[model samples]
Each structure stands twice: as C-alpha cells, then as structure tokens.
Target chain A: MTKIAKTSPESVRTVACIGAGVIGGGWVAHFLGRGYQVVAWDPAPDAEQKLRSLVDSAWPALERLGLAEGASKDNLTVAPTLAEAVAGADFVQESAPERLDLKADLLAEIDAALPEGVVVGSSTSGYSMSEMQVKAADPSRLVVGHPFNPPYLVPLVEVVGGEKSEQWAVDWASEFYRLAGKSVITMDQELPGFIGNRIQEAAWREALHMVAEGEATVAQIDQAMTDGPGLRWAFHGPCTTFHLAGGEGGMAHMLDHFGPSLKAPWTRLEAPELTTELRDRMVEQTDEVVDGRSTAELIAQRDRRMIAIMRALEEVEREEAAERGEGQA
Target chain B: MTKIAKTSPESVRTVACIGAGVIGGGWVAHFLGRGYQVVAWDPAPDAEQKLRSLVDSAWPALERLGLAEGASKDNLTVAPTLAEAVAGADFVQESAPERLDLKADLLAEIDAALPEGVVVGSSTSGYSMSEMQVKAADPSRLVVGHPFNPPYLVPLVEVVGGEKSEQWAVDWASEFYRLAGKSVITMDQELPGFIGNRIQEAAWREALHMVAEGEATVAQIDQAMTDGPGLRWAFHGPCTTFHLAGGEGGMAHMLDHFGPSLKAPWTRLEAPELTTELRDRMVEQTDEVVDGRSTAELIAQRDRRMIAIMRALEEVEREEAAERGEGQA
Candidate 1:
C-alpha cells in the first residue's frame, strides 16, 4: 500500500455530490454558495431540476449570509451519472438513501472510481461509517460527514471515520467543513448516531412517551422547549447549560442538586409503542399546530427561519470578532 | 369562596421582585427594561447595591435590544423590606433562594402583605407551585412563573398553578407575562420539575454517564451539541426536528425509522454516581473549556450571546407579524 497524504481543505475547489434529495440537494447548494464547483448526480429523473430548484430557493437566504467570493449557482453542474460526477472531482459527498447495502455499494463504487487519496464522505444520519466502509476499496479515505437538514444554512456537521479510515482523512474532512463555514464535530470513534442523533433520539423518544401518555400536547411540548431550554441550547449544550445553572460551583454543584432527580421516573428512553391511536393523535395535533401547510410549505418556512437564526448568529460572531481585533490592537 | 376576576395584564404598572440573588435581580432588570416600575427587596444587607449593580451590568445588552418606551434603570427601586416591596405593586415575582422552607415562609409573608387578588409568582426551578403554595395564606395567587437564567434575556417562563391556585390568578399571570414580552407555557398540572427541567435533567444524566465512561470530554459533549443538533433545537424542538428529518412522511415515518435504535442503551436515564474522580474530571475539563475565565466573564459572554439570539429572533418575529397583518388586511 502506498502511503497517501490527505488533501488540504482550501486546495480542493471542485466537489461532487451524489444523490440529490433534500440532504444532497442542500449540500450542492451549500457548496455552490461557498464558491466550490459542485458536480452532483441523482438517479431520480427530475433530480437535476429539483436540485436546481433547491439551490435557487436557498440562494436568497445564502445571499443574505453573504456568499463566498465568486460564489454563484452557475458553479453547479448536475452530472448524469455517479461515475461522471466523481470522475475529476477533488472530493465526493455521498448522500444516498439510508439503506445499508445500497450505501455500501455506492461508497464502494465511488471508492473504486475516485483518484488515489481523494477522500469521500457520506451524509448519513445514523449509519456508522464502519458498516458502510466494509466494501470500499480505499476505505481509509471514506469518512462520515453527517449534516443536519437544510445543510446550506445550519452550521453543524458531524465528521467521523470508520475503523478502516485513516486519521488524516478525518482531519481533512473536519478542516474542510470548518473552511466551508460549518461548525464541525470530529468524533474520536464511530459512535452510533454519531453524537447529535443519539441525544436527539433520546429526547425524541421521551417526547413520544409524553404524547402517548397524554402528559402534554404536541404544541405544549414544543412551546416548553422553544420558550425554555431551547433558547439556551442555541448557544450552549446541555452540559454547559447545567454548568451555568450550577451557579459559581459550575457542574459539580449542578450534579449535587439534580443528581437524585435524574433517577426519578420522569423520562423513559424506551421507544413508546407507536400505536395507531398514538400516531393519529400526534398527526392531528401536529397538523393543528402546523395548520394545513404542505410539506414543501413547511420546509420553506423551516429554511427561512433557519436562515434568520444563522444570519443572526453570524452577525454576532462577526461583531465579536471585530471587537476582539480592536481590543488586540 | 368568591371567585376573583383576572387582573388586566395591561393595567400592570408597578411590579415587585422579592429576593435579590441572580434570578431575582434578573427579574428586576427584566421588569425595568420592559418599562415597568420595579420595587425589589432582599434580606441581605448588600442586596440593594448588588441588585443595582446587576441591573447596571445587564443594561447595555438590554439597550441594544431596544428598550421599551420609558424604560430605564431609574425605574428600579430597592425597597427596604419584603412588605415594602409589595406595598404598591401591581404584580409580585418571588425569586427567593431555592430552599423550600425559606420560599414557603417568604411566600406566606407576601400573601399576607399583598393586596387582594394581586398574583404572586415564584421563580422556583425545582419546586412545584403546589409545594411552595402550602405556606401561603392565599395559595391561589402563588403560581410558579419559573424563568431561565438571566431572566432578562431568555423569553421562556413556565407558569403553573398549585392545587389551590385560582384559575383567574393563573390566567392573570399568564397574560401579564405575555404582555411583558415573555413566552408563557401555562402548564395544566404541576408535574415534578415541570417539563423543561425533567428533559434537561434526563439529558444531563446521560451526559454524565458518557463522562464517567470516558466516551467524551466535557468540551466534546458541549461541542457535540452546540455545533450539532443544538442549532436546530433553537428553532424546532426534538420532535419537530426529527419529523423534518423523516423526509416528507413526517413524525410517523421518523418513529418507525429511528425509534428502535433509541432502546439500544446508548443513554442511561438513571443518574450516574458522581464519584470524586468523575467530578474532578468534569471540573477540570470545564475549566479548560472556561479557560481561566472567571465565572463572571462566562456569564457576561452567555448573556451577550443570548441577547444577540433574542434580538435576531425578535427581528424574524417582527417580520412575520407584519406579514400576518398584511394577510389580514
């Protein structure tokens, strides 16, 4: 095996996106908006049109966030085939459907076709990179670079590598995501659901239990978070929030106060049986909350709101940066 | 028993904030910033000066958010005693220490001194209104109006009534909080720890479990959240974020896909025993994250970031309100 050095994040200009559904299309838009030449491919016949539409819809919001120098939708090229998409690309992002065998095959194909040492990433939400890397030829360079929905706007991207993956590739992906204006979490190991989804799934399951038990309506639960801890979550995680809640003692004092309550029968991590009755109640309650908005309409609304938050956070960061520079001067 | 009519939220001009710790001082700053005359009381001899200092420290950020008409620190008055604070108050907010006995005695004193039908809300994070109301002469008006830290910035206020609480008093408190620009979750029943704290406690326990197992560091866990799902959490609760993640099919599809993985035992809701070793590690890791910054500095940073997020959210809300008004027109 020839030793390979990892690609520099800034040196990579042309990026490839495979599978152009919501996640993939969002990636395409994000890359294009950041001044990367994005070549994308999807098996769906209408994927090109849909990808373009996703990019178009995201453009106005991206424009507000300020695009990278020379960044334009004209930088995107929708390839007709997977191989064509990755043929001359410096990096590849596979956002295929969530089937294990399908992802394994897709990653293997991209691995076989890619140039030596050119790393490839999967935008998988739950699949561990180890499971998907089993079939890849250059498994050492394949990493999981999981991103949240509307990836063009949300700053988070969980980057990790499988057992077969080399450290440099993971580092490359982390740096690349950061360079692309993302807040990246590079995991030391291939934790299931990475880190984000596990916490989310835990909380989501508890929420389902609450709904199933009629402890709270869907609307009330949403309000409980949005108007409560969710606000703090925007800037700090649960641990840090607890640290702050600890007053001057920090996390130690927090544990002493609430440690016993953690054992109380307040939250159940087990998935509630999704009975038809429960399902109907949730759907009805959610429909009531959402008020007859189509999925597309809801998605648009989410994207718009996400943009506002991202822009606001960005402005704060920029202002803080300027202030720090002034202080240093 | 005669039923009390709810006090008009708009009629509230003077508010009383009892206690002058961080939470109480925050409430005083919030009330004054909202253009209400705030009369505050605390038993500590230095409380008056401390309360004034807190309000002064918080004033600049509040000013950036744009003060309510006539809002000023001059509106805050440090009352000589608890009774004097509530003497001419339109509403009373109790943010006494978290000890139940102290709060019980304090609430009873306030109830004895308050004008008839004036609602008194306690900012208790752990105790239910029912527990705290046990000592009050008029328990009906002693509802829980729990706000997050730095109550002046976070919009969430969990309002719940005790068993003896009058429906009209709860309604009056809810309307008053909303009028003052707070998001109110009028919980139907007093569940232990209320809703937000339970969820937070659950997640906090799991985070401790990970820390004990050496799965991640304090910084890693925090980054895993703030740079990962924490962003979405700002706008959507866990359920909605998962629903959005399930593609066009919604929550039902999401439940079917990821529900079982939840039971894989990644998270332990039962509290992990906080060993001295674990506690030390947490303190040290947190110290590294805090990086020699004083607690006061960390709080200032948190407050600044929170104000930025709040202002941004306010902007989005203002635009949406305008859009809705146009639609109605």
Candidate 2:
C-alpha cells in the first residue's frame, strides 16, 4: 500500500469532484454554496457547459438557503484532465457512472493522482466501498460517501468504510460532512444498498408491483404518499411513526397488536419472522430511539413539526401560483 | 335491506363516530375542528375521557392550521350507546378495533340506525370494505375512509368502495372529505392495505429485516429517512422524485438506466417483471404527472419546496430548543 498523505478535515479548503454529471455537479454546487473552491473534471465533451449551467440554476435555491460567507458561483473551475483536477486538492469526491469496471478504474486513477493522505469519498449510491476499493493501491483512505438526489438541498450523506479502509478515514469523512452542514449516518460495516436505499428500494419495488399488476395508477401511488405517510415522514420515520400509532402503548404495544398482521400480504415482500429475539431488539431499539421522551411528548413534537411543514408547503404552493399568475399576465 | 339514509354530503351537520380510540378520537377531533357536531361512542368505559383528552391535545395543532368557521371542541358529545350516537346523524364513521367480526357487527348496527341515504364510512386501515360489509343489510352505503394517524393534522383520507358499495357513495365520501379540508384519494377498487399503507408496510418490513439481522439500528433507519428521501417525499412522491433523478431525460431515461439494478439484492423484496408494457405504462403515467412542465421547472419547484421545508424544520428545532432551555431555567 502507498503511504497516505496527511490532512485534517478542518484544514481542507479545496474539493475535487470527478465525473461532473448530475451527482458530481450537485457536489460542486453544494461545496461552492458552502464557500469552498471546487475543481471538477469530466470526460464528456460538453461537461463544462452542463456543469456551469447546473450551478447557475441551483444558485438561487442556495442563496435562499443562505450561502456560507464568501460563497459564490465563480469559485468553480472545470479542469480538462482528472489528474489536474486533483493535483492541488485537499479532498476528493468521485461520482462516476455506476458501472463497476468504470468506477474501479476511475477510483484507481483518482487514488494515483490525489495527494498522499487526502481522503477520497466515492458517491456510489449502491456500490460498497469494498467493491470499489479493490483496484486502488491505497484503499485505506477510500470511503463511501453516498448522497441522495440534489445533494445541495438534501442533508443526508451516508458514510461507510470498506474492509481495507481505516476507521479514522471513515470517521474523518463523517465529521467533514457534518461540518459542511450535512446530516451524516456513519455505518460500522458494509451492507448492500446501505440503509436508506434498501428501505427506499423496498417501497419502490412494491410501487412497481402495483403498476405492473394494474392495481393502481402511478398518479395514485404518488398521491397516496404525498398526502398520507409522506407528510408524517417529512419529520418522522416509519419506525417512530408506528410507535406513535400505538398511542400511549408505544412500539411494544404496536408490535404486539400488529405482529400478526406482518404475515398478511401487505406487500410482495415477506417480513422476517417476528421472533422473540427480533421482537425484543426492535422494542429495545425503538425505546432507545424514544430516548427518555414520553410518547406524549414525542407526539407533541411531531405535531408541531408537521404543522410547520404543512404551512411551509402551503406557502410554497401559494408562491408558485402567484408566480404563474404573474407569468400569464 | 333497511332503507338507506337520505342526507347529502352538503347537509352533513352531525357526524356519528363509533369506537372512540386513537383513530376514532382523531375523527372526532377532525370533525369538531371543521365545525361539525361529533357524537362518539366506544365500549370501553374510559373511552370518553380518553377521546376528549386526545381532542384537547390535538386542538392546538388544528388551531395552528386555522380552524373552520364556528369550529369548537364543545361541538363533541360522548354518547352512551351506539344507537344514541347515530340517532339523527347525517353521516356515520366507524373506527372500531381491526377485528373483522367486530367491524361487521358495528357496520350492521350503524346501518340499522342511521337515517336513509346517509353514507357510513369505515376507518379500517387494512381490512377491505367488502369483507366488512358482508354482514351489513345496506352494504351499498359502506365505504372505506381510512385516515392516517392524528387525523386532525395530516390531510390524507383515502376513500374506496367495496364490491357492494355504490359509486355514488364513494364519490360522496371523497367529496365530503375534500369539503372538510382533507386531501382525498378515491380508489376504483379494493386492494389490500390500500395504497399508502402498502408502500409504508413494504418499507416498514424492510426496516424490520435490517433490525432482525443486526444490519442497522432503529435510530439509523429513522435518520436515513428523515434526512434523505423523506425530505423529497414531503412534496414529491417516489415516482416523481425518480423522474427528477433522470436529469433531462426524466423517467424514461431513468427506467433505461437504473432498470437493471432492479434485480440487485437491495431489499428482500422481489421487483415485478419490468416488461415493455410496464415500462411504457410507467413512462406514460409519469409523463402525465409531469403534464406540460419541463424537468427544469420541476427541479426548481422541488428545490424551492425543499428549501422551505428545511427552513420550517430549522425554525421548529429552534423553538423546541428554546422551550427546553426555558424549562431548565
């Protein structure tokens, strides 16, 4: 393994984003909005123009979100070569296409070009860092820093290390993302699709089944979500929401009451048997999630946030309607 | 069959709510907040007190959302008997326990007492209305009007007809829900778990698998959603969100690009066969969702709404923190 370069998360000022497509361009916008100097590289002939336009379009949203001090769109540069992009970079984020061969080769190239100790984060939504790190000589510094769509707006960045990755590298990337105003979920081990994608994929597949069987329309599925569970999920997750559904009884009561229904054909996916051990763990973990807050308190907090979210959505709809009216006039 | 109730959706002055637990009590709160007199009945002795307290707790959130004209908690009454509750009632909503026998019996009882032509809606989350209406004499009037938790706040109320239900009843329930300031999704046919719960259940089951296998914690799962897809789902559903992820090409390009990964073991759930028919349907339906708007316009709308949502969340957090600090003092 090659000797790694030394750098601290706080000392990083320059970010090199390889593969300036949607996700890569998003990272450019996110970093730039945070007042960082962003250097991007992509092999596509018109990549520069597309990247610049993406940044320009995302600027107003970032401005409304309150850009970091000294943040500006002009702080971006599209490099002609990958090596030149990472030559003076303090950190690297690679968002190449999902083809494993292409990702491995590009990761290896980035590893060879990036400075000795600077951590390299791959924005692979599904691939584990272990799979991508296989071709790199210094895989110790590589970690998966998967982000959701429109990384500039969404705050989640799931971080995890490969088998060969150093725990410190994973920790550093997590801390760096947190410092950059992103909510980070750091995993101890690699899991297929990680946490978010696995849950999302399950729901997505079920939706596909509905459409395939002609059981529901795509518009109905979308409407069902935005109007129902999606409203609660804006501030709460499925687990906590269920806990609240149990009323004062909490998750334990919820499991006991609804455990039998798990066998019901709610979705195409069969649930794991609610064994004693699984039941205990879920009940325990959910209690830990409750974290000393009473069910009533949690419900109150949820209501407050949900009410605020609805108001915000209403305001947005009003603004859009007003803008449309103005355009029509 | 007993002659049906004769009240129209417009003349629904008083709503009879049977089985006053969480969902039933929520219906009570919802109707009361919409300026309707609500008479509630439950077998449990303490249900009246519990229902009142729930309404009291939910009132503040409803107030924040702006109560309808003349809406008040004083509009509610705790009826001693099921017959008393539905006497002269213009509409009946049954929120009994999820037991099929109990629901069928309750529906029959409500049907026997309700005025002619008045529609009776069951708040059954999973059981199809067909099964519940099996024992009712006037099954044509029974429809499912399932609402999410805390019915007073969340706007979604899914309306669907049973095999025996009249299309007019389904349409009336849907219209009534809309008139009450609730978002309504009317379904043409019965499907197990309806739409929202199926999608939610699929995700929930996947989450249970993770916790069952020790792959992730409950907190991590919740965090993954709240920080990731949950933000987007507040305004956009999974399909539209995927459509946006396709960049300029929209859902068609997305299906072509990521369709292969459907076979990946992202979740234990098996995806449906992505035949050409399904593909064309999804593409066409998603295009319908998009209507005449360009991908760029949709992205900009998504960004504006997301930014507003984030700001709303931040503000709520600050208020909660301040309250906690005040409590400490």
Candidate 3:
C-alpha cells in the first residue's frame, strides 16, 4: 500500500521544485507568491541564475494578482542538487524536459530521496503519469499535475493518477493544488493529453491546416479566435456557448439542430504534416506578427492581458453570486 | 458586369434582415443599436413578437456596451413580406435555416426584390456563398458575412465572396462590417465553415468525443477551457499563444520543440456518431450542469460575462497603446 503525507494539504509550507526551466520557474514563482518556501534545482549550468531571472520577471504580475501573506522572493532557495531540494519538502513538483527516460530517471531519483508519504506531482503536458512512474520506487505517490504555460497566472491545473497510483495520493494532490489557489479538474482515468490539451490541440491543428492550405493567414486565424469564439470561451466553454446559441431549447435543441452538420467535412480531421515548406511558412508568418518584438516583450504583454481577463472573470462571478444573494464563488 | 451600389458602404442607411430566428434577431438588434433603421421579415407567424423579444433582451447588453448615436429599438420595423423588407435597403443580411436549396432559393428571391447592386450578406453558418449564390440573379453582389452567435456582442465577422462573387462586393461588405463596429476577417477563399467555425468546430468535436467516451463530463471540459486556454485566447490566439509558450525561443522554437507531438493521438480526429444514446447522455449531463436555469437566464449571464471580458481586453489594448505612445488600436 502507498503511504499518505502526514502534513495536511492546507498546512503544506515547503515545496521542492525540480528541473527549473520555464514551467519549473513559473511554479517556483507561484509557490513563492503563495507564501510557501520553495527549494528549486535544475541540471543546467546557469539554472540558478536563469531561474532567479524568470522569478524576478514574474514577480510584478504576481504582485498585481495580490500575493499571499508573507509571500516574498526571499523565501525561495536555489538548492545545490535534486536530493537536497526534495529532502525537506512536504511536497515535490518535477518539471523536467519532456524526454521520457530523463523524466523517469528524475522521478526515481526524487522518489529515492524524498521522505516517505510525500506526494510528487509532475508538470508534464504530454506523457501520462503511468509512463513516468514505471522507474520510480514509490510510483504509488506520483501523480500528474499538468498545468498550462506560465502556471503562475493560468489558474487551471489538471490532476490525475496513473495506473499504479493510489486514490489517496490523487486526492491529496488535488486538494493540495486547490489549497495552493488553483482551479483543478481531477480525472479518474489516464487519457492522452487529458481535457484541455485534447481540445486545444484540435483547434491548433485546424489553425495549422488553414495556414498550410492558404485558406487563411496566421494573423486572420488568430483574429478569428480572439474576436469571436475566444471571447465566448473566456466565460463559457464550447458546450455551454452552443447551449446558449440554441436559445430556448438548450443542449437538446443544439444537438438536434447541428448534430448532422457534424458529419460535414468542415474541419480537416487529420493533422497536417509539418513539412519543411509548412514549417517555414509558419515560422515566417509568426515572425511577421512578432515583428521585431522580443519574446520577453511578448511574455510581458501576454501576462498583463491574462491578468486583466482573469480579474474581469472574477468580477463577473462575484456579481453573479451577489445577484444570487450568495457570497463570492 | 454587375452594377455597384450607388450609395457607398460608409453611407449605408436602412438595412434589411431576412429570417428572424436567433441569428437574424441578433443582427436586427446589432443594426438598430448601431443607429441604423432596420427592416426585418420572417415567414413564421410569431416572428415579429419573437424578434422583438430577442432585441429587447439583447438591448441591455448593447446599452452596457454604449449604443451608437440615436440608437433605438423603436427604429426596428417588421415588414409584412420579404419583398417589402428588401425593397428600399442599402444592405441585406439573410439568416435563414441551413438548407442549401432553401438558402439558394431565398437568395434568388432577395436578389430579384432588392435594388440592382446592393450587397447581400448571408449569415449561413455552414453553406458557403458559392452554394447559396447559385440561383441568385446578382450572384456577384452576394457574400458571406458570417457572425458568431449573438452578433450584437461578439465582434468577429468573417466576410468572403463566392466563386462568382466580384472582388468589389467582398471589399464593400468587409468594409461595411468593419464600419458597423465589428472585427472583420476577409477571406480570399471559402473553406468549409470559414475561419472561426472551422477552428471552433474542431474544438467542439473533441469535446463530443470526450463526452461520448466518458473521459470527461460536460462541466469538466468547459471548466478546463474557461480556466486554461480560453483565458489566454481572450487576448492572443492559438498560434501566438504557442509562440509565447516557447519562452525566449518564440514560435520558431515552439514549432521545432512541440510540432512533432502534433502526430500524437491526443485528439480524436474523427467526429463521434451522434447516436440516440450519446445524444441522451449529452442532454442529461448538460441539464445537470445547467441545473434548471432557463435559456434566457443563461443568455443574460453569457452576455454579461462576454461584455466584461471584451472590456477587459479593450483596457489591455489601450494600456499597451499608451505604453507605445500611440493611438488606440
């Protein structure tokens, strides 16, 4: 049987973040902003300096979102090694590169080093927890805690257990993520790409198809989303948006009305090949849009816009709750 | 050669709206709110009352968005016949049901009734203008002005001419839609579903697959979006988003890094069969999430949320422009 963490999810104080790149650094920023001590380690030669730089860049956005009590950049530590990082942590988050062998070796190393019953959550966007846990000693405690990019700002964290994972560990990770101020969706089974990625990948593939076929330019595709469905998606998901579109009939009417059209060859079902021509076209078009702006500048722009949208959503939810004569949701 | 409208698109005054269901009524409301006299017609007996009700319901949202000068719901008139509706209009928008034969016949009727060169925009979600313009007398003047649901709120309008459609007509319709306060995307070719729907239909198909396979509930899929990519999408579209996700590397790096994973079977490529059982499950699950809220209530809620997000995006754009020492974008 797998052991459970002794510390309750709400009481977790120190978190170990392994392999601090973009996702890991974002996690460091998030944990530090939430008033927890974060110990981070990465194998890159200048990882400590780069991680600090990433955190420093993310600090202003976190401040705008309102930091937790006692949250400070000083609370973060650059551990000398992976073992040192996980030795005293109540929880561990591994954000290594997406290579399967590297991820498995890292998880096993962390498993061997961590105290018994400590939960380990991996920030893998693709691989299933089951695939990564095969090499770990305490595979039962490892869970997938997939998050969107810039995890410090995006609120969603999908929590799911592997085939060897214990339900208690899954529940523990889910609770811990929620307690860390995240909107979490816990899934029972291991599905490839999970929920968000599956839907998003489909959309992305469609965009690629359009660009490949010259049906629309990159700017036009992006504009189509931001101006149209993307706005609705900010508040409502695809299903609910369609439900509202049905007017008086709701989902039943929506399915009955548009279901047959689903068979129409509107969307290119197969993924487009990333041929050299396609790749060059995409890169060139994207460069045109980026248009001399540095990635750092784009990141800053993206973070600001995300914060504004999130605040707007929060306000909407609060108003709706108030209208319902209830407290904040 | 087809004659061009005597009145420039910038000077279009009275507008004709054919078919007064959800899409048509939304158009009526949008035109009226934009301070244009609106003539509407639908063959159904209760068309006038329903159209009026829909316009009335959408009015609050338009008011919140700041209606144009002299905008008034009282300016809308429901004509007794289709000919009357199109007789004196400078522009016509046909929002009939999605049957190709019905649409072609209706466009032909509208073409015969209207002035020689007034551009006609079809709000058909599925059929392209090429198919709908087949029987029309002035096919050159017919174009697709596909708007997302609730055209009064969502700013995206995709404009494209049919195979026989003149470039001049497409340009005029695109410019006119932009003038009417929409973010317009002018497509050179008519791909199935145009820009927004193609991308959106891809995402929606993935959702249906998840529900049909029992991988996720309706609520979970929706939550994944609202809390994740949907938020990012409010400001940046999918292509730019992945570019941002590439960190210091930008899109060139992103395509190189994650482009290979496009082949991963993360998304179910094929659309699910909409069997009776799947339909029942979808309706039942949606009902559970909706929790007995009337469609009108849902629409009101959706509108409030969309307005809030759009305003938030506008604020971000304004701040960015100010930072750049430029006028508002």
- Stretches off by above 4 angstroms in model 2 are A1-5, A326-329, B1-5, B326-329
Interface RMSD of each candidate, angstroms, one decimal: 13.1, 0.8, 12.7
All candidates' TM-scores? 0.79, 0.97, 0.83
Candidate 1, residues B222-305, lDDT tens digits: the string is 667766666566645665555555554445455556445545555553223333443333333333333454433432343344
- Ranking of all candidate structures by their TM-score, best first: 2, 3, 1
Candidates in descending lDDT order: 2, 3, 1
Q: Write the per-residue lDDT of candidate 2 for residues A17-79, one digit (tens) a residue.
A: 999899999999999999999999999999999999999999999999999999999899888
lDDT of 3 by residue, B1-329 (tens): 46667579889999999999989998999999999999999999999998998888778667766699999999999999999999999999999988999999999999999888799999988888988899977799999999987788778999999999999899999999999998999998888889898899889888777765668777788889988889778756787676556555555556656666877888966433333443333334333444565543543453355446656866888988988899767
Instruction: List candidate 3 segments past 4 Å from native.
Output: A270-329, B270-329
* TM (chain A), candidate 1: 0.81
* lDDT score, candidate 1, position A120: 87
Indicate the worst ten consecutive residues by lDDT in candidate 1 chain B.
B278-287
**All candidates in order of DockQ, best leading:** 2, 3, 1
Query: What TM-score would chain A of each candidate receive against the reference chain A?
Result: 0.81, 0.97, 0.82
What lDDT would candidate 1 get against the real structure?
0.73
Error of 2 at A214 (Å): 1.2
Candidate 2's residue-wise lDDT over B1-329, tens digit each? Answer: 43344766777899999988888898999999999999999999789888889999999988998888999999999888888999968888899999999899989989888767889889998799989999888899899999988888878888999999988889888888898888898887788989889999999999999999889999999999999999888879889988998888998998988999999999999989899999999999999999978989999999999999989988988888888785321
What's the TM-score of chain B for every model shown? 0.81, 0.97, 0.82
- The global C-alpha lDDT for each of the candidates, from Candidate 1 onward, is 0.73, 0.90, 0.81
